[model samples]
Target: MNGPKKEIPLCEVCQQPANQICGGCKLVYYCSKAHQKLGWREGHKFKCCAFKVQYSETFGRHMVATRDIKQGEMILKEKPAVMGPRMSGPAHCLSCGKKLEPMKIKEIYDFYKCTSCNWPMCGPECEKADIHKAECKIMTDRKYKCTIKYEQPDKTEAAYCVIAPLRALLMKDSNPQQYENIMALESHLEDRINTPLYVILKANLVTFIIQVLGLPFDEDSILKVASIYDTNAFDVRCLDGSKRLRAIYVTASMMNHNCKPNTRHIYLGDNYNLAVIATVPISKGEMITLTYTQTLLGTLDRSKLLKINKCFECVCERCRDPTEFGTYIGSIYCSICNGPFGNGIEKRPMLISSNPLDETATWKCEKCDHFILSRQMFWGNNALSQELMKIRKDGPEKFEEFIEKYSQTLHPNNHLVLQAKLALLQIYGNYKGYTLSELPDHLLKRKLDLCHELLELADQLEPGWSRFRGTILLDLQAAMVVQTKRDYEAEKITKEGVQDELMESMVLLQEAANILRVEPEMRPTLEAKIEELTRFLQTPE
Candidate 1:
């Protein structure tokens, strides 16, 4: 007998034995033209990629760079497999996820509603939008009218919770391939069950999908969908920033979390296509990473957030270092070494966690050898953060007071002080009465110093082509330009000195423009700034 017939590869979507392979990658198999389209939209278009998926015991499924990737090089771009409103939110258009304005009493009757489903939508076009069509049919078939009134447009609506889960459930029959892709994502159901959000989802979402909508899904299955969403969905801000929605991208979600991620992603256009780009040069075979938490957060806070939200403790290089790569953004200045209790020495001993990964770890002063409970440190930081939130709206004076008051107790580069300074950076030049032209020479210098300090911290913490760095670069360039002109007017600098400063500001602006190149909303503004700066620099002295 001939050797057993060679086993055929299975379709990626349906898993049926298949002969057709993707012509581009020749790596993935599809059963039909329809499934091919689905596969491409799901991720294969980008998966013929600079990276390849790999599995390990530590990182179950993650992407790895297949070849060297330069800074700002696009790694992957794919449309969201599923997108819908957040768990709870204000009234929003069912079609586009835009916040819906409250309809006045007279206009309520004429307000745009899906002709079939009677659900409020943005307009006639949205009434026929594909995203809303499936769910609208289900609600209409079940005779469930949306009772969400126009009153209290900003108040969080409990009824809005059902839309996303309902959409995911509808996928079971409406689109089996997408349903399979979504269900295959990490759910963390075991970890999520009986948690506060889990309980709320179960009581509100699960019950409604089963009893109210009359969907034939069990509580566990429904909650599993919610768990998948909670674990994997990206919080997408609408183009106008008026509303936030959630979307799941199968390939993008697989990258493991790192404190200092090698990659940055931006959502593009109305369809929310995501483009993941390398923030720094990535070597071949390196595992791809994306930060699930804010880069400005300290090690302890980062660990806490990752543990709670992503279901893992990050022991990355940054988290493992007590000094956080010497930035010491998380550490408190030791009172005996740097505070009033000391002899005013230049020594900068700091209190840092003995075990960064352990929540109950003791914090020991590097010089004084004094130890404090991690809980105590946590409470202290929490209180300070609360105070920071309160004074954030009070403008520059409050921020100055906050920085001065904590400078002795906290490390100079402490995350809280950095946050206060970042706030001041925006307020100093943009706020009324604090505009760049109105800003005094001393305050201008202060702003320049703040930019330098924060940019240095950003380089260490969130380095290279990052949105955070891009924003700071914009602020820095603006401050430099204003200060240079002020110095020129006051005769503090010569014409050549002015030329040198303007040239430096031009470089800063170009860097900012390059960094924000992939951002659609920022492109026009950046382009305008670049043109204006180029003209100024080229003009005669």
Candidate 2:
């Protein structure tokens, strides 16, 4: 009493019902000579060979520098195992993640949907979409149907819990070797079960995928899939720029988290392939690290965010230092002198408890001996964030007003103030009334000052050739270019000074170009600026 062998699907390459397994891996299905040739030519053959990724327990399955990795060296680049919408509300095309037409369900149904399964698709081309095909067939076979209108906004995001796991499961049928990679990842399932998202998934996704579809997935398997996604998935922009996606990378995910990491990843091929490059020189046998959070944030916020999201309090070198590498980006204005704590340049102003690692470690001012409670700092940050959000729509004038109002209450290098200043730096050159040419000499100097100050802070927090530093470098280059031109035009500089200024501006632009060439969003803009600066430098002053 055995059921007949389950029918295998058609060729993914040609959408034909005929099946010819790949001789190399026997994972992919294709029909005809031309289609198999097309598949291999499109880079499928290389992935079929597989990457030799090693893991370890110290960093909980991490990658290392196989050799001395030079700065800006390309380490690994591969397509993600799975990709889907982020855990946020925004309706998009299920197949390609393009924006869905709002309130157009019947119209969507008429245009989209596989010929048989009736799941939403952009067109007939996506009928054989890797993750959706099997899931769609199961939904159709089990008489399960999604009741929500196809065009409903964010309906896909509401089901984020199930989509990722479903994607993982579908990968099992399509690519068994890659499925082994997925299973090898750490899920931390034991710790995740008590979380709110797990509970919700247990109630909804578990029942739908297992009970409704009768897919043979057990509770443990489903939880493991969810945990894998939670730990390994990255919020990435889609390959087509249609929408943002949570991309589950394999080797890239193995790099452990560090607040001051030596490596960074630049997504390529529309977020399909990722290039993990060294931002600093990494020696052979050294463990590679990547920052999993925004680096511009201070230690407290970075540590807390990592703990909440990744389930680990970062005790990295940056987090343990009360000085935060002498930036004092985390400290508040000392009650007495109204300056940042731990700013020990002229007079040291901070003392930590002997055990700096302890949860209750005390931070006291050396100048006024004023002890600032953790609660005050926490609430102050929240209050400032709320106020900034309220005035975010207003011009740079409002931002300056906000900064001046709290200049004494907050540290000079406080995260909020720095963020506002960064905003103003961008606005000064691009906004209508404050366009670059229209800015007064004083304002130009002000913009240049902000760029230099922020660049220095970036050197501390986001060291090496990180995206933040690259952005600041580009801003600094632009400011220097304008300032040099103004100085030359106004005859305010000697011949040698003019030459020196031009030289410095040219170097800044080239440095920025070096850093930003890897970033997809900024590369075009920075390259254009570099071309302009190169031409400007060539001309006689």
Candidate 3:
């Protein structure tokens, strides 16, 4: 007997062989169907799958979270996803297992034909998608060839995977307005590789096209084609130990972008999931947002990121302010005129671009009654964020200053601020000497205050019952526990008060459990923690 036929871990959902492992952090395997459903329910439906481990250099080595992760707690840490050559040579059609034809020349590289249908194979499976079927007919009549490049066997250079369905997306739709949208998308797709909106759209479109084609957009099997620098790429270090093409989707893309997103997205190795959190107190039915670009950029850089990536002029509060308002205290309302400085007011100075022969770049605040050199007032926050990334390995001590600096420079209530704070909390709470109990009273109080402020912001920024909110509630409860302990030590509170505190902690802990979610392995630990806390609260002091 052949040893039970070697039970392959078939994805319960898609029933595909789970071959590809999540490279970000190895917590899930995706054959195809299982990964997609898991990604959707677990929040990896549209993005790359991620792992459960967080890379922390804060302790000078890779550090993992000690406690059960509350939802929105940073679990996996990684660099931006990198693009690489597809590992399997001669890209095969996912549906029919047919090989894709390479573009013979650069000018004709844009054209492709379906292997089975001969309907302009964008790649092998391109013939299967309904969107491509019509276009395939049209292309078959015109005999259009693609101008895209292909990877040669001799070299390791990365090549763009020719996507067939998108080509058909250019064909006119029945609705006049919808047709116009498709045409616009076609034009946009032509130059999308250079734009941020392209990255976002590609991520989303991959999901839609996969579903329409009736192909499983699973973690291990889905194909991705893009340049090395594309932002949508995932850092799959564990699977092949090198980057390769991976699919991302757009149905999840309808949500708008923000620098400080209230909803936290997680990858389940096959799909991405979105969980709402309070980046700021959010009201019901408000727009849920995610940041398409970093929010730390100055006014000029902010505008550039938005225009380049999202393809829209951000009229958001921060973009409109010349002073980079909401970033820091200095950039707020100018002192003299009571209007925001550098916002170009009647009395305040304007930030002018000086062209030695033309006009020099400088900021004048009519409201502030002063002018600041653009260079000093306009440092690149993105560059600074990169620097912070470098120092991330240094751990909690170094981050104290960064927290203060960033909070002062960026809006205290900004989404980046929240991410940074989460990082800070992880560092402080997880590190050996940086526990909240060890901090000086004043500093500890300040930390609690900051946590409270973050919760307040989360309430406004993500109104839904998201993991982010659950994580904050857990953090707040933990801080309160420490505070109560300190108060008891100082003889400021009675034993009964501490008991009440315990009760409060129990309620908050339950709330955290209600909202926070993690991988299957960690669920047991979270449940245990909740049970332990419940028992403590139930015990008579």
Q: Choose the strongest candidate by TM-score.
A: 1
- Give per-residue CA lDDT, model 3, range 1-541, as digits (tens): 5566776765535656786655433445677654755755775543442211232333111122232233344433232221122323454333222344556655554236555434324464446755345534544455544333344533332112334333323323434453343222212233455456345545654554454343334421222222212323222222222222332222223345554455554444422222223333333334445565544334455556555544455555444444333233224223334334334434332332222111125645533445556555445444655667766644656666766766424445433455566677665544666677677676667667766776665554344455556766777777777788788878888889888988888788777775655433336756876776666556533
Pairs of colliding residues, candidate 2 = 91-154, 239-270
TM-score winner, 1 or 2: 1
TM-score of each: 0.89, 0.81, 0.47
Of 1 and 3, which scores higher on TM-score? 1
Residue-by-residue lDDT tens digits, candidate 1, 1-541:
7998888899999999877877644467888999999988998775667788888988899989877788998888989988889877777887788888755546463345677877767888999889998888878898878776655437777777778878888889988998999999999999989789888888888878888888889998999898899889898885568867899998898899889999899999889898998888999889989988888888888888877887888888999999899999899977766656675746778898898878789999988778899988899999999999998564699999999998778887888988898899989899999988899989989988988998898798888889888988998898888887778888999888888889999899988988898998998989988887787687615
Clashes of 2: 2
- Candidate 1 lDDT trough over 10 residues, lowest sum: 102-111
Ranking of candidates on lDDT, top first:
1, 2, 3
- Residue 400 deviation, candidate 3, in Å? 2.8
Count the clashes in each prediction: 0, 2, 70
RMSD of each: 6.3, 11.2, 18.6
Write the number of the candidate with greater lDDT, choosing between 1 and 2.
1
Off by over 4 Å in 2: 1-57, 99-131, 147-157, 238-242, 337-362, 494-497, 520-523
Residue 346 displacement (Å), model 3 = 22
